[model samples]
Target: MSSKQRFIKSVVATAKADAPAMPWARGARRAAFIAKRSGVEMDKKAA
Candidate 1:
């Protein structure tokens, strides 16, 4: 597999693995995972 594909696979795997039990917490965790992996700052909270 290509490097980019491998990265995506790993990202999904990690996101799934780190998901929380609660639905709301799971969504937050998923968002955090995406932001962290994409190297984007999540300083602003959603209103």
Candidate 2:
């Protein structure tokens, strides 16, 4: 897969891995993943 695709997959995997332990972190990770995929930078403070 291409680098971009690989990044997306990795982000998803990471979010999944973190979900069970920390719900907030998982949500942040998911938001960040979506932002990254959309070529935007998420506001960390907001998250």
Candidate 3:
């Protein structure tokens, strides 16, 4: 179980690391993705 969990985590981490984030965007898409994964509610009013 531990090894499987480690492998999954590593895969996700690697995918994140390989993704492109432009200099102007500063990884905003990645931040939203991580927030969504953690069940954070997006505030449409602010957006």
TM-score per candidate: 0.40, 0.40, 0.37
Please provide, for model 1 over 1-47, each residue's C-alpha lDDT reduced to its tens digit, 9 standing for 90 to 100: 99999999999999988955775566665777778899987755631
* Predictions in order: lDDT: 0.76, 0.79, 0.74
| Winning candidate number (lDDT) | 2
Whichever of 1 and 3 has more TM-score, that candidate is: 1
Please list the Cα RMSD from the true structure of every candidate, rounded to 1 decimal place.
13.1, 13.6, 11.7
> Which scores higher on lDDT, 1 or 3?
1
Local accuracy of candidate 3 as per-residue lDDT tens digits, 6-44? 999999999988977565565556666666899997665
lDDT of 2 by residue, 1-47 (tens): 99999999999999888745565466676878778899997787855
User: Comparing candidate 1 with candidate 2, which one achieves the higher lDDT?
Assistant: 2
Instruction: Rank the models by TM-score, top first.
Output: 1, 2, 3
Candidate 1's error at 32, in angstroms?
Answer: 24
Deviation in Å, model 1, residue 43 alpha carbon: 30
